[model samples]
Target: MLDTSTDIRLVKKAIRGSVDAYGELIEIHKNYLYRMAYLHSGTEDAALEIVQETILKGFHSIKTLRNPELFRSWITRILIHISIDFHRKSVPSIQIDENLPETRSLGISIEERLDLYEAIRQLPEKYRLVIVLKYFDDLKQDEIAGIMNIPRGTVAAYLTRARKELRRSLKEGYLNG
Candidate 1:
């Protein structure tokens, strides 16, 4: 397997003018990109939309990116931007705690996992985005910062806030039950 850094180099070259190189880069990162989208969007349709749009924007804008080694984060940044655009145009509503399940079925209950995803979805977008990328996607803080175009400190802050909010949400769930 090509090391990730090696792949980035090839992708950079392809983005400049080499279609074959760009194609190879896409082949490598497409699955990861889709997964990242799916995790954040919480629906297959939105995830699929982000993935398709991200790839298209990446091709169109790749030449403007200076660091070839940062393609994963860069592409993710594009995906986030696309998602933000969609969110802004989406129907607005008051922030109510959304309905959730009560179990998580890995020997846990289905309701637990549903509750988890529901709580996560309730997080303010910035905090939720960081948590999803950091925990669900297993990305490092630095990488997340790059992807979000925020400082590492900001990413840490968002993560802290997200956890606190999630804990409170779950506590409320317990109380209500």
Candidate 2:
């Protein structure tokens, strides 16, 4: 005789033996995760795979999570790792043309955002991870540190360096023009 009200609490606790609860988590976060994966991968098929893989792994490891409130950040970190791993194995040399247009434009012209994304794309893994986690995800430095299991000072340094590098890239663009 399980009621709907009790069902929710039960579901949250059912990370041990219930696929339904996992499905609920997926239903809630799948679209957002797919968007994040698409931003990182630039392909729908690859992004879908990343989302699916992330959900699968996260579901299997839910017991390791101590706080339910950390679920989003936890899942996001998993997605980031999975996306980077896929890129490393699949893309050799990670190339990008400085002149290529940004893809996020709709009405306001996403040129700056695209430029930023391109600059980020050129960064080495460590710096790039920090930038994406901080800027793109709009995460606080402390939250980024928590999810990354890193020092907050390291997060700040990465963001600072990433900003400098992006500025250099933009300046190069102007000089070329």
Best-fitting candidate, measured by TM-score? Answer: 1
Model 1 regions lying over 4 Å from their true place: 91-108, 172-177
Residue lDDT tens for model 1, 1-177: 235777967876876788787778888988887777765666666677888988888888888878777777777888888877766665543232233212222243557655766687778889878977876677889888878888999999888888888879877432120
TM-score for each of the candidates: 0.81, 0.77
Give candidate 2's whole-model lDDT.
Answer: 0.70
lDDT per residue, candidate 2, 66-137, as tens digits?
Answer: 656667787888998999889887765444333432333323235665565667777777788886666556
Q: lDDT values of the candidates?
A: 0.72, 0.70
User: Candidate 1, 86: how far from true, in Å?
Assistant: 1.7
| Cα error of candidate 1 at position 36, Å | 1.4
The C-alpha local distance difference test score for the whole of candidate 1 amounts to 0.72
